[model samples]
Target: MEIDSYFIGQLASEEKMKEINPVLSNVKVNDSNQLQFFIEVNNGLDIPADYEKYFKNQVIRCFESNLNSSEWDDLSNKGRYFRDDQFLKFAKNKLFIFKVDVNDSLIGTRLNVTKNSLIVKEKPKNISSNNEKTLTTIPIFRDFNVNKFEKNILDSKSIGSYEYLQEIRSPYIVCGEYLYGEFKNFEKLNDGWHVEYEDQIKKIPIDFNKYKDDILITEHALYLDENFLYDTLIEQGLEKLGTIITKENKIYVKEIDNTTNDFIEEIISEHEFLSTYKSNLKAKNLVYDSKQIINFHTSIKTRKLVILSGPSGTGKTQLVFNYAESLGINNSKSQFNLIPVKPSWTEDSDLIGYLDTINNIYRPSETGLIDTLIEANNNTDNIYVICFDEMNLAKVEHYFSQFLSVLELQGNERKLSLYNKEFIGRVFNADRYPPEIPIRDNVFFVGTINQDESSNSIPDKVLDRCNLIELVTPENYIELWSKSISNSLYKNELKQENKVETVTRSMLNEWGDWHGENVLNNKEIEIIKQLSNLFNSTFTIGFRTLNHINSYLANLPKNQELDREEAFDLQIAQKITPKIRGNSEELEKVFDEENGIFKILSKYQFKISNQILRRKKKELDIYGYTY
Candidate 1:
């Protein structure tokens, strides 16, 4: 996952290919000025005899082919992210691999060999000045590997806020889009200029361990699971196949390193967590489907805060309490703290605490929520689940404002300010309760809101930060209850296999490029865009919701119990559909069968969300407002 896994190259026409390097005269181009991976042809023997099967995703992009005298141009835009003189001297080959950014329309990461990727090969020439001018044949097929090259490949400092880009670039990988200064780091190191960010994003935390020898626990560290690098080397006939993954896999961010997140993902995804959680729920006489458990887990990972809404007695609160227990977090005072929100609460002090300045003491809420946050900071390695029962009893925006603002800050910066910094020494338990309690990454905040007249409505800001899931009441409640009772006949009968274990903070952070191809492919992204447009007019939300949906999709179990499409269908239901609210008269056109909500629901194969909406439309008709 180094940044140099990609190279910035231009898509050439057949004629353009002939003009730059006539040795590839027989090569054909797919389309003009398109970006892709490619291969070269020389003497009708660029590839192995049976190359088609392996090289289907690659096209041919020589220096030039169809260029007229007036159309003279460089086949690759190598000047974009690098200094021409510096890059030319150190670059081993034109084919070097690089990493892809989350928001990259420009840079591509090394992954699958799907449709067409640009395969690049240089027509080899020996040093002619006082040296032999040996003609080197081209590689018919080549793959990519980030570990093929060493770090500080450019041997320079980063030019801007995307400073980490300088460290991950390597000389011997085929990083395709990197020539674009992003693909390339376009700013010259010596020039000392910085690129402006398109969005007003706060500068990302520096990857402090970029050069460290140790594989420290950090989100900035990249891991690539694809074998593109090995395949590329074989295609070029550069390496004998490796029978077993040895030091190579460990040194690179390849799979064998067995990252903590990878281990957690494998464990949960392989039915260890799923089966245990489902069993625990049933054993507790709770009736819920696998989809609900999956959605709940995905929501917890998508954002630390999860809002559960339903009519009374739908098991919203029980799910949170039971799921934590399945993970063996039975300690109510520490890792599991349930603070029942009082209905009359109206301010931040009601939830977090108060200054009590007259006595120069911080009186934390009796609920002990602050104590859990303090505990979270001390035990950063373990998870802390804090649930606000009846969270909607009071307006969430009032009591939870501090958390709403601070959770937006990432890593160690997320802190809840209790009082003035000067009061730390004056507070009763300065050592035990620091003035500012850091909301460590391991802390999970769950809220249960019973959707009755007693509860308050959640504002868009709260909805923006949290994934609000409205629990679907089972159609046949009596039957479900009977089944659950039968299933729980013996409390000790449930098998102890696949017992839930403590999940770490790393599992939450390393969900992997929500915006990139690794998580959701081009087809899925297209579907999201279509849905986004439809929701724009009626169900307005910001970029956070989109990203949460992607993360949720990325974290779905790899087991056949749930597919990506089905998980995404639930996400549209859980994340977007819950926000729909208005008078039935006003929303009638928006949910009309021909177009709008119903049309969008049917357009994509969102069967589950659509089913939920069917009841929603009916409820809106009878009750006038449905959420």
Candidate 2:
């Protein structure tokens, strides 16, 4: 008995057979009970590469089973066997042979009269198609002979032969004298197959016969795929084509063709012009006087190093990060770095970089200060901020002395020596080899300190170089807590709106105009002169401190949140009083007899200054030191 062709097609369409081997292109059966199947090996289907062997064994089992048995009655058993039990069983008893052909290679296996099967032929062998060898060649052409078929086909055809090539499975086709195809996708262009379909042309990854004069041409109406063209432009280092952005499902490509410096200036200008003015620390939900915020900004502009010192829990570190966030830094490592000073640090290498003699590579400290400086050197247009949290944990003059000296130098003199030789390289990759790195002007450094037994005192040299801002815990706990909760809720709402903008250097310089007037009024100058006279060389005020005081006063907000006298008094308390600490009896002579307050030598008196001075006096009278 022979298996029916209809039964074979039904078996091929079964759900079970489709799941097991859907790539089977056709199935046939011979009078000798031999089953044959042709499956695609690489026809872009999801079939596995090794499916030929698995499908051949499954087809043999399907024919050997009894289809009309009780087990075969279940609908789930559709692909287990064909429905004709008599024919399949009779064919199985006689003999069962299965052959699979893939990519023109025939592989066969035979089942004995019993139920066992073995390989009838070992390795796969090439098979001939008609009288042709059917060797796989490049730029494959159609089988039609134009000379023979032109009389019938050409007369009736509306579209040209090249137009039909678009519907072919292969990506290439030869017609008349040229190879024609559409670019399925254009990833890159090299010396390979060149295709043309209509106006669209591309160089693909197929080979062509060197002897053929295949010239491809098309009308100029077609355009290359935008994504493919954009990628190719970038891969060729033609970045002047700029970037592509999608909004509302439409793509917009922006091209830039300016010099590097001009391009950076444009980006900075855009950021600054788009940014809205707000309090420096407003984003962090902290309520501080507007004058203090301006003063902080001015200090950063004037002096690159700023010190935030006060008691712990006064939001010192929070202030540093909040100021950076307000400038759109957001604590990104490329723009900002937070180095926690360790108690064990005693030398510059512990904070900057050191030579690993055993590895012969220079290793930057865990603080990443060297990496941050290197980045600043490479990107001069942008600003970089570094915060030293709890900086007093280490002796500042010892570990931070290198920065103190290097920062004072100008231009090329500001280079920091990291290794002894000029060819020192990093441990991981030697390509990044640098013996000295310049400390760029664009970087800003901030330090937060808490004075206690666990921390060391900041030396006078460190104090003289940087601006000092003092923060005390808020007196109104109830109001602070309530506002914190409300600000958090407000930020959540703001996040939903997704409003983001950048702040830039030029904007900062323009904003500094709020403090454009550097002149000091008579009363302000008198107050400074009195303070300097009263200190009497014991704690003499220098020109830097005087300049900083004038700058702070000039930069105060025009809204008059703090009166001139009040603002000057706050500066006196922060900039001068913090430096006035001693166990000498001469300091006691400056204290008031009645309230133990340090009396101002000038005729004009400030209540805030009196309070801060009295507090320092009490500390000096008892603990022998005042912070």
Best by TM-score: 1
Each model's Cα RMSD:
19.2, 32.7
TM-score to native of every candidate shown: 0.54, 0.51
Error of 2 at 524 (Å): 3.0
lDDT assessment of candidate 2: 0.50
Runs in model 2 deviating more than 4 A are 1-285, 357-359, 409-413, 420-433, 484-488, 491-498, 513-518, 554-564, 592-607, 623-627
- Give candidate 2's error at residue 193 in angstroms: 64
Count of steric clashes across candidates, in order: 57, 0
Give the least accurate 10-residue stretch of model 2, judged by summed lDDT.
1-10
Model 1 bad stretches (over 4 Å): 1-270, 422-425, 494-518, 535-539, 584-589, 619-627
Q: Rate the local accuracy (lDDT) of all candidates.
A: 0.53, 0.50
Over 196-234, each residue of candidate 2 has an lDDT whose tens digit, in order, gives 234332222222223122211111011112233234422
